[model samples]
Target: MEQQEVKTPEAVAMLDMLKAVPQQGKFMFGHHDDPVYGIGWDGDSARSDVKSVCGDYPAVMSFDLGRIEIYGDKNLDNVSTDRIRQEVVAQYERGGMVSFSWHADNPLTGKDSWDVSDSTVVKSILPGGANHDKFMGWLDKIADYLNSIQTADGTKVPVLFRPWHEHTGSWFWWGQNLCSTEDYKALWKMTYDRMQEKGATQLIYAYSPGTEPKDSTEYLERYPGDEIVDLIGVDAYQYDKDTFGQNLENALTIMTQVSKAHGKAMAVTETGYETIPDSVWWTGTLLPAIEKYPISYVLVWRNARERENHYYAPYPGQVSAADFVRFYEHPKTVFAEDMKQFEKKK
Candidate 1:
């Protein structure tokens, strides 16, 4: 396959690892904010809900850059950038992969990411728009952060950078209903170019839309281009057991087809049932839904420390803990300890 051309050796190797994962008949399991916090603890680097439930940490550790665009000391979740940097490096050192998602604040409305009050937000951040320069500054902050992720020897750690995600939904300012197709494409390209110009080379870009694309056509409706995206992913959550399995299967089929045609990797960028109400959700629902697909990884959302009913992955004594152990022990599921081979490539 003709892979996307990345600038750095680390990024090239990381992309290769993503490409080779499914060929080996395995898909990595991931968790958002796994090392930073968990269901009952905060700021503990040694703690991970997935690890507590199973025996190893997730293969992919996802972080957010929501407040990074504004030069905030902490992310929107109040996790400090210093902590994120530390944990990101720690995860990489542990032979695990790191992925970042950005929920950038609305530049036009000066509100949160969910502020889709203005329809011209995407247009205003393009090259010639009024907020163009300001947006460029925001990208600079992002670039700086990305560039700062380094090992003890100062070697940059390769990371999967996912920005402007879930654009298929109408919740964020950059959503489909708020921006034209051309403008959205331009936004992705501009971010890519800026990262390159600023020397943030150890990045593999992922383009992920919200779930339920009818087919490959709809999945790629707002695709920036194969040149800018190293991975094709989708964010699908389980609202109910009845429809989630078939829905996920259908989405993965579309993702597989699109990824093969475009020579990009594919993943379930975000997924999980809130609170894991079902005891066998891991193996019975999620595992079965994705087992047949050639996906690189499946990342569930965070296990929030504050909200009682807002967690995704299981904790130590959660109802799904036993079943999660089964999922972890499954040969098809890959975790941090199982990533040594891929880490060798880096």
Candidate 2:
């Protein structure tokens, strides 16, 4: 791997580990909300469920920093600020990794992340725009929170910070069709620069676009640059029960090629078949889609227990429980217990 400038020793070690993943013949399995929320579970219940099924927890744990911009209370998705920091530190201590996604609400439209009502949201957040200062304030709050995440030994908990993700889709205001390429690039650069100015150096930035690209050109059409991006990935979901598998394969292939050309790590940042109605979806569909690529990690979306048909991982009695165990036991998949390999590299 070529020498690259990064913020922390953890970040440097993480890049080295990711670059060496192909030779390792394993990809870390990540679960969103595994530590914060779960299906018919939370906290230890979720971890216990994973342990009962696979005899280990997920190697990477995820949390969302959505409401931090608006509320300033660290209450995004029902997770408190203090608990989120504690969870990240705890995972780090246990030889696991942490990643965070942001679904920041539109500061101008006052709408959710999906709102593309005003295409100017991205432009407005750039330097000298209407909402530029307000957006900077939001970044400051995020920086303060990130700076506070430290382990018992006071080492910064390195985070895979994924912001402005899935931007290839037309849903978010920063989407390709909604904002100009230059405007979107400016948005990403400004956010990164502001966060750096506010002392959030422990973040490893990831650029993830929505899935199903025709070729590498489409995947890198809106790329900010290789300098500001540490990882490249795709956020694809299995919507069509039968055809989504092929789309996932195509997307991963394109992302893998592009990431390698840029000398960056790639990942399946977000993916899942909700409800997991197919008994063998884990080993049958999800595993096959990612196994061919030298990606760093594959993270499924959260399993919202309160909502029916909103989960990705199999729980105690779910139909796919047996197949999920098979997926976990696969030689190419790495769970929590297996993460010691990376920590040892550090």
Worst 10 residues of 2 by lDDT: 43-52
Best by lDDT: 1
Q: What is the Cα-based TM-score of model 1?
A: 0.97
lDDT of 2 by residue, 1-346 (tens): 6443357887677677666665687899888887666667665523645565667888888899998867777655777888888888878878788889999888888888888888888888888899989888888888888888997777788889999998888888788788898988888888888877766778898999987468999888888898899999889898886778888888888887887688888888889888889999998888887898888899988888678779887778888989989999899998888877776442
lDDT of 1 by residue, 1-346 (tens): 6544456887788888898889999999999999888887998758888888888999999999998777568889999998999988998888889999999999888899999888999999998999999999999998998888899999899999999999998999999899999999999999999998888889999999977578898888889898789998989998888888888888898988898889999999999999998999999899999999999999999988877889999998899999999999999989999998766432
Give the alpha-carbon lDDT of every model.
0.90, 0.83
Clashes of 1: 0
